[model samples]
Target chain A: MIDSGIRLPWNRRLKLLIAYDGSSFSGWQRQKHDRTIQGEIEKCLSIMTNEDIFLHGAGRTDGGVHAEGMVAHFDCSSRIPDQNFMRGLNSMLPGAIRILDTNTCDPSFHARFSAIGKKYHYTVFTGKVHPPRIRLYSHHVTAPLNLATINSCLQAVVGTHDFSSFENSGSRDKSLTGGRGAVRTIYSARLLQQDKDCLVFEFIGDGFLKNMVRNLVGTILEAGRGKFDAEQFAAILAAKDRSSGGPTAPPQGLFLKQVFYQDRTLDHCISGKD
Target chain B: MIDSGIRLPWNRRLKLLIAYDGSSFSGWQRQKHDRTIQGEIEKCLSIMTNEDIFLHGAGRTDGGVHAEGMVAHFDCSSRIPDQNFMRGLNSMLPGAIRILDTNTCDPSFHARFSAIGKKYHYTVFTGKVHPPRIRLYSHHVTAPLNLATINSCLQAVVGTHDFSSFENSGSRDKSLTGGRGAVRTIYSARLLQQDKDCLVFEFIGDGFLKNMVRNLVGTILEAGRGKFDAEQFAAILAAKDRSSGGPTAPPQGLFLKQVFYQDRTLDHCISGKD
Candidate 1:
């Protein structure tokens, strides 16, 4: 029965922990004319397993947005060991993308649907001169920033709120939102000062809308630069309109840090944070 | 006197502190067709000053080798402020390359001729899984490395000695060596363990030959992997032949950390160490 290569009862579902530089990729989703994370991985998988593979990512990140910890899943009938998958994929995929860990999961597990939360990190360099080494990974801002005001804005982002003001146009899906209309729960939001010149904003939420993190960062930066205060930030949140917010931040500084599942404990390890 | 634009007594020599990613550049030297650090800066300088510009670097770094405190100098007749040159060059140059600081210097000072010593760093990753974010900046090796053995090799490297075993062929310049041949003084050599898996080798010396740092690092790594011991490493040095040494390490892991001058104080600050 196994030699026939038909759909067998021993088919397994595999989960992958991923990280990518994102500078060389068009985006996370596969496209006909562009190099993307999904397309590259799927092609390698098909070659290895000799079966057409479809990869489902937790979420799609925009072009040039990096990821330190991402989650994805695929089904394969090949009897290859779990560790070989990581080695095989890394050898074939570009150095910019890597499969950090792989394991077999329950058949019912879904990369997108079963996710309980996600974590993101957006880095901003407030130095006088942006260092060349981190140019591809950070956003540079020379202007003075008031951290107190930015913290206040971050405080307002906690709890359940309608984040329509931060969401961009044309990516909302009624099925994905479950008719919540741009409403989501924010578990935690805070700022980490890695150094005098590096500001890292960490956000862990139930889910995020398209371009939501970048929009929040842009608007919060305006608050930090003394364009407005916590009151205005609250007002913008209450407005629930995209036009009420500031411009979207550039993509290079953003990173999809991790995805949280219901069964896994939150790991504070700072892997791939560079 | 300033209006004529001829070579006047007021023509000042300007020193520039530069940092570049180096992954995009061919090398530090100017080439007719290839993009290089010197070529890019000279082009921008010529346009800014409306005169042909020649940049003299403290030393030439090979392609794919990064730098943080690389120094260079050029003679300019334009009376642009030192700060403006920094800003103007940074604005025109690619983000991978940056002019960190600029200032006027004595007319007699030469970038390469006046260097008293130099510092270099080589990074190696011995982790089971090399992280994707630093793949371009660090060399990855999975074999277990013995730090004690490597440190012994490093200790053996200090003091004046002939380094022919660690120098590659075809870059010897008799005028620059001053008839010293491969003889050079290593002021200090040490290994810094940044983390459990990252090993950084720091070398300070009066001068280094072509491929010397990379060659030393490659030989030291072989020692760390138990391919040889300290006595054998000493024998390799005593052999005074390139064929007796280990292979040259790749360029991506190497960084020209700083160039010392006779009068300048040694700043222990870890600027551009990343």
Candidate 2:
């Protein structure tokens, strides 16, 4: 039975933590005529449990990006098992999609609206060439990357800013189509080594605009590769121009690290902060 | 350069510790007719380095049997830098095969004949049902397994004996065809668990006869499933008849764990005294 005390006939809300390899997906959101992660998940759920599920994810990732701690929410009929909910969903999803954890949360807790923080990581592989085994998980950089130069530029992006300089221009304007706001806050950012030849750029924030993290990664990489100095990063901030950012990094290297909320107990994650 | 220590102008020997998914591979050894891991590696090397090669392996794993630390040796004309050996080999191999470690071992080191100890692991997920994500790596035993009774039966396979009973009756008998002696020593055999649902049966030995480990795993599994009495394993060994043996386990749940040597620095492994 679900967590509702008056079990057996009413709708019960549940939170699910998910992970997926996004190579074959268009994005997280569903479209009328496209292959998306949300579309596949909902289709599978409709077949397995015989319910029309409207799954809401914390963020929308582009094609070929990955997710290790994506947060989603859906409601189901009263027949769902509380302890084995994750087990049942995992049995129906494809190998690339996995439900890491699940729990019952307050009905008011929405995955997209209630999320307090989100984290993302961008992977970069070093060396003069690439390895085929790791090519799927990292972006290969032929030029030498200095960590100190990139770290200096990341320091400027660590606080609240308009962030209009680091995102797709059309998406940023589209988000404010209904006379809304466009400012957001960044908490922390750092880089890590995932393997011998691969490095990761990680960012944690209250929220992000479209393509903001990828744009920031490409900017820092330009500084690391000696194409620009930290002064250029500062100049880009002053200009508030999307074209000031470097080339967009590939989608294969980006990962949704985590999503945070107060009510969901299944928010604990292994890859990033919750 | 070879074990002879003479500078050979046309050849360079390379030794690699390899890992693979094995789900889409034919086997480790190359056949004149079939597409196998070794065959593909040779083909890719020929294309990349523009040289012919003869691939050698530590053991012949069956189709769908994975390898985490399988040792292999090959000779080619391209004199790759010692530092770039792993990266270069991995660039040519398929996504499923990865060269974990690479070294320039002596020509005298035949991966198969000149071996000391080898370890193999078989994973069993015991419960009423198992999660589909972990299903490829483990065997599902729907029936209850008695650990204590199964442990007792493992003792019967610890010493040197005529393993004719464990051999697959349908297999090509290398023992009858002037092969190495079938009597080999089992150094260690026990069940290991890294997680709750994942139970691993590890066997360390000098060498294994064709289908010996799978048959051994099947017999012990029968005891674990309570299908055969605990004492029946000893009777099965004494019968020295293939008909008395249990069923051969599926290759999907098996992995070549490691090939051990007396010293990691040496180019060759010490042969087993037994």
Candidate 3:
């Protein structure tokens, strides 16, 4: 402590708030051959810091799934200012991905492990003619839907329950305590009318299984179309079997809107309501 | 008294409300060697009707300029219903363009000549880190700007005035009664704070010269940055010289929002505020 001249490792941990269109990305993971959100960001960080860097995202969004407030963390030894990270990464990243904000964080702040909650949004275009400008960001449903029916179906999705029926087969592990980890808590499920032609479904949950949001939306949509009555929807959830749920909706309409942490200092990054 | 059996050439004039993300288009006009909005639509119509079709758009948006409600008209002898045109054209056209609505119009109706007014929108992203998802639709301006100063500049842009200083030199015509035709009426000009980081400039006018809206935004931005005072901006407008105005803003931030026609029947097309 007396020798102030001695140099110390920067040993700084950085957090990043990222946004992407997801039209061209394969997914959020780092794949050897496929283009991905994590792969792209790591490449840019490597170039900027001149060192191999690795990133851990809050969630692994599938291909064609967008994110507005996806949180990530990386450890770096570079002595550059925090602002430079934002500028340098954005300058090197593709036009489809952006570093919305950057900040230095506590070394113990893990992107995935310390996360407390997540919010997902799915958009459905209910217009007669879907606009080309938003085709990649919304699911076009030309069939008229009964909103009241869909809202009732959503009520059956909230609360702590076994959501095995909503999980995709590929993500299931029967060996994990006999599939006891399939339980998750949903705090709120809302259907917001963004405009005359757009309906946004928002789900805030303590956790989500693979393909859970899309499958839930698919089940609710079927109810809206009058294919399944309210009683049948409850029965599907109670079955706890994958075959009991509807088909998974397309991935293009799904978005990881926000990742919540315990500190809540990063809440400013989540701007604007859907 | 008319003969219903014989079709009088079917001489039906149809008007279409189109929306497009112009990132992939060369412009609204048809160029022999470029992909354009008009060229793509006309080609689709030709394939569907098996006839050479010509289209007239309300405005010729430059390359990279988007449109939310651009209007166009075409004449066809095909006896298909109006709904078919909307479905057929959309099915054949590329994903960047969409036909929102289609209807048969009076033979006297024209897309450009009959337009009584037009509205254009320019978006400027004032955030420190520009979101890549909106890079093609907004201009990135990181400099802090004064909203009061910009609003004062915009106040001077409204009302009738000679806009020669705002027009691009290539679009100017000195032979039109010694450039007297440059005088046009601006109905309203508004600077909207879309969010904490986005500023939208909306211009409504009876007519606008080429590059007028972009140039006006450029000038207003300069004033917002304290580059010029409100007096200097008013002086620039009065100068009536192209060199007196600020540089023309980039085309990517520009949008043809809507076109107003004298027939109140078309008023329904312009719904919702900016």
- DockQ leader: 1
Candidate 1 vs. true structure, TM-score: 0.94
Clash pairs for candidate 1: none
User: Which pairs of residues clash in candidate 2, taking residues 3 or more apart in a chain or in different chains?
Assistant: B3-B107
lDDT of each: 0.90, 0.76, 0.86
Measured as a fraction from 0 to 1, the native contacts recovered by model 1 come to 0.72
Can you write out model 2's per-residue Cα lDDT over A124-229, one digit (the tens) per residue?
A: 9886445443456678787888888898888878777777778786664454333334467777777777676788887877788888888888888989999988
Q: Which stretches of candidate 1 lie above 4 Å from their native place?
A: A1-9, A263-274, B1-9, B267-274
**Candidate 3 C-alpha lDDT tens digits along A47-131:** 8888889998988899999999999999889977788899888888887898888988899999987887898999999988777
What is candidate 1's lDDT per residue for B3-88, written digit by digit as tens?
66534346889999999988889999999899999999999999999999999999999899999999999998888888999999
CA displacement after TM-score superposition, residue A156 of candidate 2 (Å):
3.1
Question: Candidate 3: DockQ?
Answer: 0.66
Sort all candidates by DockQ, best to worst. 1, 3, 2
What are the per-model DockQ values? 0.78, 0.15, 0.66
- On the 0 to 100 scale, the lDDT of residue B92 in model 3 is 90
- In model 3, state the lDDT of residue B264: 55
Which one wins by TM-score: 1 or 2? 1
